[model samples]
Target chain A: MSAPFAKLPRWADYGLIPLINLFVAFIVAGLVVMLVGENPFRAAMILVEGAFGRGQNIAYTLYYATNFIFTGLAVAVAFHAGLFNIGGEGQAYIAGLGVAFVALSLDTVLPWYLTFPIAIVAAAGFGALWALIPAYLQAKRDSHVVITTIMFNYIAGSLMVYMLVDVIKPLGSMAPQTRPFEAGAQLPKLNWIIELFGAKIRSAPLNLSFILALIMAYLVWLLIWRTKLGYEIRTLGFSSKAARYAGISESRIIIITMLISGALAGMMALNPTMGDQHNVSLDFVSQAGFVGIAVALMGRSHPAGIIPAAILFGALYQGGAELAFEMPNISRDMIVIIQGLVILFAGALEHMFRPTIQTLFASLSPRSVGLAAAKKEGA
Target chain B: MDFLNALVLILDSTIRLSVPLLLACLAGLYSERAGVFDIGLEGKMLAGAFAGAAGAAVTGSAWLGLLCGILVSVGMALVHGFASITHRGNQIVSGVAINFIAAGSTIILGQAWFQQGGRTPALGAAQRFEAIELPGAAALRDVPLIGQIYSELISGHSLLTYFAFLMVPFTWWVLYRTRFGLRLRAVGENPAAVDTAGVSVAWLRYRAVICTGILTGIAGCYLSMVQNAGFVKDMTAGKGFIALAALIFAKWKPVNAMFACLLFGFLDAASIRLQGTPIMGVRVPVQLMQALPYILTVILLAGFIGKAIPPRAGGVPYVKER
Candidate 1:
């Protein structure tokens, strides 16, 4: 079959298109900054300086990037199985309970390493359990995952509030958060990693969880590309009818993919609950789940691509806080604006400029176009 | 008499809360019935609340504020159309984008324009929609049960609330009795068939989307100008999602949507009253009550209540076979 839209080279399809989309998103974001009566160029400088200027700032950027990577990978896994798992926010939020429970119970008795492994299992277990209901509904009951997931997010929020306020708040303490974890429960800071570069810096929350995120990214790559289950997921994503014809169980793949996605999302809580805050606070997730959607879309649902994309957003978060402090007119909500624009251009309006770019490339390579036409005729 | 008095109060609050939900549910009904599922209703309502409050504050005219809200929502709807229809992009993704864009831009613009920290200035009585007492409310209020119901329950609502209630039957007529409605439903169920019959599927869907924008815009206006004095950041909360749930619970019927919204709204009103109040000697937690609507929606969607079958072509961008 002839291509409905002209297909470009692999390099152009992956590299050039995403680069252009990112450029357009930022350019529009710059315009929004200008609308707020701030100089977009100055804002950019501040954002860059705030995110990367100091060792501490860089550490903070990495810390934030660590969360994005986990959540982004979660979204990527679901995307592979043709599911929109927007419930990552809810899944990760609920996982805080598991992480805190393990820390609160085991931190005093067990060592850090022991607590860490148990926390991982508990977090992943809770997140997967949270996702199981929605996944089951989608697979067996014909309930749309998108709507169910959104509803689940709301339910999770309410549940967390109740748990914090009524169940876990220490009797005398007014705050809706637990007391800080014991030293054994806390993850070790990765400040030494930055020190290796010969940069003297203040302590940042960058922790061992960052390493864990990288490991998960690598594992995700293997799972999606190397495993039989991954092959089924990809096939189901491409077409349900074809997958069914090939004797793959659509319901099973969807359930497994969603569980994996939820587990990755749940693990995101570790970055903050154990790595940075050392306590489960109200709203620790704080829109990171939504950020994952943007990261996954911009990353094109691949681990290699997701790492850099997550860091770019991490820079936005770190720098946006600093920018909000420096410029009263431009608040931290500017980062949210940029995120929305990125999702709009990268995910929704992805192919807006593809036709024009394809035509331009065809015109530039007339000989290749003739060879493509000759090949099509021969076929 | 005291119990009766409390019941009236709860039902009254229920009516007040349900207006926005009712309007938004109808908005989603129009969009989804036309094969375009809009989860962005929340965002549009939020943007409308900001615009409505800002316009009223600037012009001192609530009517103009409503107009401003409608215009802004329609603009957002057109953006959805451009992405999902013209570009043939994923409808859900486009809706998600719209939601985020509205959520962010409203706050940024509100802060920039008003300098009140992501809110519009408080509106005065002249700048807002005030409750209208019916012709005989005062005289009839002194009478018995019928009088109390008429004066307290039926009357004493902002004009927009009445408009919302009237919209129920009007929506039913528009959906079932009009030729445009027939074409809209047909397009949603099978766009290819509509295209084969020489009706422009794109145009039909665009019109339906515009209708959604108008209804949601009015709902937003009600929140800021009628229900409250000004626009607060994220004021719409999760009402848009609640409306979507109501639409599903109603099985996409206009009349049923009104009742579903009322049912949910009553739950909300009852929850507020139930908070800190013991039921059967057990104090029900406020969080559970707050989460009741969403939990119920999940159960209903699971088909434990009944099936919620969406439009056949919902969320799929129509592509003409070459």
Candidate 2:
């Protein structure tokens, strides 16, 4: 067989290909916008301005990115171990419950400093607990994590519905929600830190959680690249038989990786529940967990890659919300079509244009020319 | 008297609720059995529902609506085949993308055409598949013990529900008793062997996926034109996923998948019935019953009932060495 286009440069393989895919996705999305009777360039400008026009807008985009970072990391953690832990959504939902329970139970008793740390632990712990069942099932029972996680998402929804509607709704209120947490339970916004640097900052939902997400990203990098367990996880992913021969336990790695992934997913709850909403409400996790799949795919499951990929999606989401407000015809749901196109190109049809691009790159490179000539002579 | 009536009512709802699940479960079965795992059943169903509603509204005929629904679903299936079979893309990612597109496009188109908040116009009786009365319904109702259960719980269902029930047996027969079924099963387990036997693996999988699309189409039409009126935004909800869970819980067998779907339907009926009702001197939350089926599915998959092994060739793209 031909040699997979004679080995493209690292920059071409990692950066250029993804960029090309994104360009293709955007082009399709533009056509969709045109079909809806909007000028594609104008619509594109709207998205760009909405995401980065002002300090507050940038803050909002970053806030959204923070959620993606947590969830993308969660997905990436599992991807490394060759597990598709689609339970990130359910894990995050269930973890929100844990966060809500801690904040509700302890906000009055403890100070902000203590409460914040406890809530973070609560979120991660709950998320991990939620993920463990499926991990255990996959490891021991031969159950597919994909199916179990999907089921758990439904169960989580039902659980949340019960918690919000029947058990936690304030006695006098008809809304399906718990009472707001005490002031101490709320997270501080990032503007305080920005102001310390003597720059005027607009108030947005951007919070300390953004900083936490960054820290988590760094920690994930350390875990995946610098540690022994990481080595085991990567080995198992590459080849189970090889890993088994090397005395690396497949089941153990699957469980550990899923647990870490679940914890990271759970950390996503910190943004919407603790950082912004200040209450566990209906569908609070929304689609962040699902969006994480796209982020991880686009980022190629790397922490360094995930950061920028997360930011790009965050912009799309924030900008989509803006487009909904500006255009009367294109509603919020229509934005999903664009998101779907991006996902289709970035994930499903990710390599549709790869071979062509590889060939194009190879023909241009001087080394490939020499290699091709040498192969022809040998033939 | 009240307790018996409640029991009858619950059974009645259970039958209605299981129709979509049964069809979608069978759809998943067909695809997976042919080595093409399709989690896009939900997306296909959504598209079918929209097209059905729109077609019925335009033509004023339920029969025409059904055709439109099937066409839309088939289109979706073809797209899935192109991505997963031809391009060798990740099946789950393609499924998820289909879902996103279906979910978004349906709402967008609905809003554009109907201007009714992402919903089609409420269909008239002529544009819907109404219930069919079983023979001697009035005579059967007065019989002492089994009368109420027979007449109230089983009879007078919509035509689609009966079709869904009939499909269970038909699916079983086809899988076990037909030449095509053998080839389908073999392709799923060991495609290379079937390929060696001169059967095209890609063609078999494509055929199965297309069959899935057709079944899901009828399921979607049933939802819009029979169970309820019109196409609502995200009307399929998580039914497709639940159908998947049911499929797994049944160990990918046709008859068992039907039972699993029924069980889920019963759970849904029970939840609706038990809502706001006191249990053991305390009010039980409606969500408890809603969650029961999913919780049970997880337990079943976790090996409480038994292990569910998927087809050996499932999720792996067939790569032939040229």
- Interface RMSD per candidate (angstroms): 0.9, 1.2
- TM-score of chain A by itself in each prediction: 0.96, 0.95
Please provide, for model 1 over B2-54, each residue's C-alpha lDDT reduced to its tens digit, 9 standing for 90 to 100: 98899999999999999999999999999999999899899889888888899
> After superposition, which runs of candidate 2 have C-alpha atoms over 4 Å from their true positions?
A1-5, A192-202, A366-374, B138-141, B144-151, B279-283
Please provide, for model 2 over B156-206, each residue's C-alpha lDDT reduced to its tens digit, 9 standing for 90 to 100.
898889999999999999899999999999989999999999989889889
The deviation in Å at residue A103 for candidate 2 is 1.9
TM, every model: 0.98, 0.95
Residue-wise lDDT of candidate 2 within A106-224, one digit each (tens)? 87888777888999999999999999988998998888888888888888888888878877888999878778988778888886654565546657888889999999999999999
Report the C-alpha displacement of residue A147, candidate 1, in angstroms.
0.7
lDDT of 1 by residue, A1-379 (tens): 4233456877888888988989999999999888989999999999999999988899999999999999999999999999999999999999999998999999999999999999999999999989999999999998999999999999999999999988998899999998899987999999888889887777799999999999999999999999999999999999999999999999999999999999999999999999998999899999999899999999999999999999999999999999988888888888888888888889889989898887777667734434456545655
Deviation of model 2 at B111, angstroms: 1.3
